[model samples]
Each structure stands twice: as structure tokens, then as C-alpha cells.
Target: MTEYSRKQEALDYHAKPKPGKLAISVTKPFTTYGELSLAYTPGVAEPVKAIRDDPEDAYRYTSKGNLVAVISNGTAVLGLGDTGALASKPVMEGKAVLFKKFADVNVFDIEVDADDPADFIDTVERIAPTFGGINLEDIAAPHCFEIEAALIERLDIPVFHDDQHGTAIIVAAGLINALELQGKTLADARIVCMGAGAAGVASMKLLLEMGAQLDNVFMCDRRGVIHADRDDLSEHKAQFATKTDLRSVDDAIAQADVFIGLSGPDTVSKEQIATMPARPIVFALSNPTPEISPEDARSVRDDLIMATGRSDYPNQINNVLGFPYIFRGALDVRARRINMAMCVAAARAMGELARQPVPNSVLEAHEQREMAFGPDYIVPSPFDPRLIDYIPPAVARAAVDTGVARTEYPSHYPQPVVETDRD
Candidate 1:
């Protein structure tokens, strides 16, 4: 589609049929005056009183068990920088759509206008009672890191920054499969990451936690490689800073086994990609336009396995594959937090799922009759029905095993038929 047509279609999509992508619906009977009494006045008061007796009862009587808040300050929208909170509502609403459609999780898209991280944290904590979990969206780095940490400490519910950990989880999943295909492992690979922002920092951290050696990973930002010699590094960047002589992204990519780009468009040249050794794994995750286009990257070496954030390409490292299912498991078990165990479990599950035979539904969705766990098919498709049954149980089991769960393992996890008030 042409750029103008695409813009018009997007605008019309949000403007027509409804003013936005979401609406509130009553999930219980309310047509009759008798039902109204139960929904609002005397009968509602019974559940309210029960909740007052024990705060845990709120999940029993309310939508809090399956409801998530998609919160954003809009400082760093994907492909669009600092669009502001109000401008970010459409994106958050889009996130809500994904949450509901993919995992059947109800969502409230909240756009906070607070500039201060503490203020944003306070606002979220005050409204924390309404949600089973919080999915922070599009907030810029450093602050995104701070807000997530603060809220995770203060709130009992699961809090996740999708741009950070969600992206990272999916990256880990694809990378695991990619490594298997390339005969490489995270522990020994020379990995060059061309970004020091939220996704870059979080991806590196998760990989480190998953057994990637700190010295084997090289991180670069606008000023070049994050090194111990750089005095201007933030704490997050400092965590990856090394004493290497490699000063640029290009320098880091040479002889590296993996090149992961969470940076800007075309930041790494074809010449730079050509410098990598045989059987390199490349994830050019910069959206809309990658650091190096697959065509250009592939032209350099036939042994390269590539992934991108765009769905147009094969092996897309999509957050949609991670967040919904992760939260589904968390909500099912009433988990207090989405910890490292849960994330690693989800990643491992996703990696393993791709190796299984592709379901017909997944093949049909992608206009394919068959797909194997190879270079292009390293991660499970977002539309794969097995995702509902596969990843969430792994996450829920991990949550239970790690002692973060408030409830026992649910016996009724299915592609469930949710009870709605529709008559």
C-alpha cells in the first residue's frame, strides 16, 4: 500500500464503526429492574461487603482476575519517538486489542500525563486495585526501567514493561531456536547488540541470566560501544560496559556470532554485516526499517539467519507472542510478579513449540501448508492455537514452582469458553 493510502486507512479504521478500538461492556445481567438491583444497589453491596471483609474476595466477585491495565506515558512509541501520553492512547488501545483478542484478557488502556517517574508510579499504584496485572507500554528507557522496578516492588500484582521484557522474551525464544539451528549457544557466542535503550538493556540482561557470559556480549549506542572508559554511561548501560578496544558497532560485529539490532534504521552498513563470521544470527529488530534489510544482509553471506520486528519478514521477533500468554499464565495462577523463572519458562516454551509440527490453523493463517523449525520459522506464529495451551501452562507452572503464585495450579486451562453476560 502507498504511504498516503495506508495513513488514510489507519485513520479511517480508528474513526469509523467506533471512535476507538475499545469499549466497555457490562459482563453481567442488567436488563431487568431486579437484575439492576443486583448489579448496582443491594446485591452489589453484598459482594462489596464480602470484598471489604477480605481483599482477596475482590477476585472472586469482580473482573479483577482477568483484567489488565495497559499503561503508557508515550515517551518512546515504536518507530515514533516521544509522541506524548495522549497521542499514545491509540497505541495502548491497540495493545488492549491484542491482549483481549489473543489471550482473552480484558484491558484498560491508561495514558498518564505525568512527567516524573515517581508521579507515574504513584498514579499506577493508586489504581492498582482495579487490575490483575499492569502492562507498561511505550514509556522511554531509564524511566521505563525505574517505573517497572518501583511498581514491581510496591504492587502485589504482576507489572511488566512490554517494550523491555516482552521484546526481550521473544528475542530469547527466537535466539534459542536460532542458536540450535546455527549450532551455537548463548554462553560462548560473541554477541554484538546495536542499541543501549530499553530493549537492548533488557535483552542483554535476560540473556546473561540465561547463561550468556557478560564479557561475550558487546553493547553499542549512539556514541559507539558502551565501554568502561565511557564516563557518560547510565547505570543500565554501565551494566554492559566492558574494557574492550572495540569502539563502534561495526568493530563489535566483526567475527561476532550474533548481531542483534534494537537501534535505528540502517545503522549498520552492509559492509559491517559482511564482517561477521560464518553462520551468523542477525536480529534487525528496528521496526518499519531494520538496521540492515534482509535482502542486503543476505546478499553478504548465505549462512546468515535473520529476524526482524516487522511481520512482513520471516522469523519476526514479536512481543505479541510473549506478553499476552505470559499475563494469561500469571493471571490464571494469581501470581504476585512475573519473575525471571516465569520469563525463562515462557521463552523456553516458545522455543520448544516451534520445533513441534506446525498446526494447520497456523499454516493456514500464514498461507503455508508446511513449516519446520528452520532459519525462517524459528519462533511460533502469534496465530498458532497451540500458544494458548502451550506457553501459559509453562509460565503458570514456573510461577507455582517459584512460590510467587497465590492460587494452586488451575485444572481448567483451556482454549476456554469465557462466561460473558451476553444474552
Candidate 2:
């Protein structure tokens, strides 16, 4: 279909049947006056008194344990840049849809119009008690870093910035499998990362935690390479700065084993891909268009394993593969925080899941006869049923092991599947 046609289709999809992508649904019966009284009124005072006596009773009587707030300020709405909070509702709603669809987690998409970081943080903090967790989305960097750190420090429930760690988790998982396929180890791999923004910095950090050497990773922003000698680097970017003579994306990728592009379209040339060592791993993850198209990169070097942020391509490094399941696990254990240990465990779980045999259901959904653990299938599909069973357990185990969990792993967990036939 043409771009215009696709745009109209999207508009129609959201506009039809009540002019939005989501709606509130009643979870309990209200057919009788007795049910109405129980739902809201004199009967509700019982739970109110119980929760008032013990604040922890809120989890038992209310939906707070399963509710996640997908909050955003519209500063960084996907690849669209700062489109304002009102304009970002569609994306936030989409995130809510994913959370509900993937992990059976309930979500309320909140768009805060405040520009000041302090105001945004305060607003979220005031509403923190209502949610089991917070999924911060579309907030720009620098401020995003500060906001997340402050909230994580203050809030008892998990507060995760999906733009940062969600992307990092999926990218790290895919890279693990890709590097293994290329017979390369993270410790020895020479990695060049384009775009030293939220996703780039976070991905590099997670990779380092997973055993990638700092000296071997080079980070580049728009000006050029992020080096130790640079005077204008942000603290987050400075953490990954290398004391090296390489000053450009071209220079940085030369002889490198991995090239991760979170930058704009066509920023990487075929010559740069050619300069990389044999069997390189390239994740040109810029959305809508990548730093280098898979076809363009493949024309230059057929030995490379390629991934992008687009679904049409194989090995798409989508964040849906991370955030929902991660939050599910966090909520299941009543985790105090989604710590580094839990994040690493989620990544490792994702990596291992990709290597297992593909179920017939998943193969049929993708219209494929086979999908072995190889260059094209480095990450599990979002629709993979096993993810619901696999990721949360690993993450919950990590949370318990790390002492971040408030309660023991429940025996009747993973919950019952309420809706099984989802495409």
C-alpha cells in the first residue's frame, strides 16, 4: 500500500468505534443493586477500612498490584521528536495495548504536559500509589536520566524507562545470539555504537554489565565520536568515552566486530560496513528508516548478521519483546525495583529462548516452516506464547535472588490465560 493509504488506515483504525485506541472496561458484575453497592458505596467501605488499617491490604482488595501506568511527557515520541504530551497519547495508548496484550497486565496511559523535570517527577510521585509499576516513555534524555534515577530512589514500586532499558534489554539479548552465531565474544569484540542518546548509552551499559569490555566500545554522537578528550559530553555519554584516536563513525567502525546504530537514516555507508571485521554484527535500529538498510549493508558484506527496528525485516530489535514481560515479572514478585540483575536475567532469558525449538503455532503465525537459531532469528517473536511463561519466571527469580522482591514467588503464578486466541 501507498504511504498515504497506510496513514489513512491508521487514522481510521483509531477514529472508528469511539475515536480512540482504548477504552475502560468493567471487570466485575454490576447487574444488581447489591453488586452496585459492593462495587461502590456502603459495601466498598469494608475494603477501605481494611486497606486503611493495613496499607498492604490495597494489593489484596484492589487492582493496584496488576496496574501499570505508562507515563510520558511527549518530549521524545518515538522518531518524531518532541510532539507535545497531547500528541503523544496515541503512542502511550499503543504501549498500554501492548502491555495488556502481551502480559495480561492492565495499563493506564498518562500524558503529563509539564516540561519541567521536577514537575513531571512530582506529578508521577503523587500518583504512584495507584500503580504497581511505572513505565516511563517518550521522555528525552538528560532529563530522562535524572527523572528515572530520582523516581527509582523514592518509589517503592518499579519505575522503568522503556526508552532506555527496554531497548537495551532487547538489543543486548539479540546481540548475544548474533555474536554467538558469528563466533565472537562480547569481551573481545570491538564495538562501535552510533547515537549516544538514551537507547545507545543504556544498551552499551547493559552490554558492559553482561561482560563487554569498555575499552573495545566506541560511542558516537552527531558531532562525531565520543572521546575522553571531548569537553562537551554529558555525564552519561562520558561514561562510555574512550581515550582513542578514532574520531568519526567511519574511524570507529573500522575493524570492529559490531556496529549498533541508534542514529538517523543512511548515516552509515557501505564502505563503513565493509571496513568491519569478518562476520560482523550490525543492528541499524533507527526506526522507520535505519542507519543503513539491510539490503544496502548486505550488498557490501554478506558475512554480517543484520537487525533493524522495522517489523518487515528479520531480526527486528523491537522493545515489545522486553518491557511487558519485564513488568509482568516485576509485579508478580512485588519487586521493589527492576534492578540490573533482573534486567540481565531478562536479557539472558530472551537469548536462551531464541535458541530453543520453535513451536508449530509460532511457525504457522509467521507463515514459516522453520526458524532455527541463526542470524535471522536472533530474538523471539513478540507473539511467542512461551515468552509469557519464560521471561517473568526468570525475572522474578532474579528479583528474589537479588533481595528486591517483597514477597515469595507465589505458587499459583503465571496466572490463568484468560484470552488464548490472540494474533
- Among all candidates shown, the one with the greatest lDDT: 2
lDDT of 2 by residue, 375-423 (tens): 8999998879999887888888888889999888767665322221111
> Whole-model Cα lDDT per candidate?
0.90, 0.90
* Deviating ranges (above 4 Å) for candidate 2: 413-423
TM-score of each: 0.96, 0.96
Q: By summed lDDT, which 10 consecutive residues of candidate 2 come out lowest?
A: 414-423
What is the per-residue lDDT of model 1 for residues 109-194, given as tens digits with 9 covering 90 to 100?
99999879999999999999999999999998889989999999999999999999999999988898888789888888889998
lDDT of 2 at 31: 100
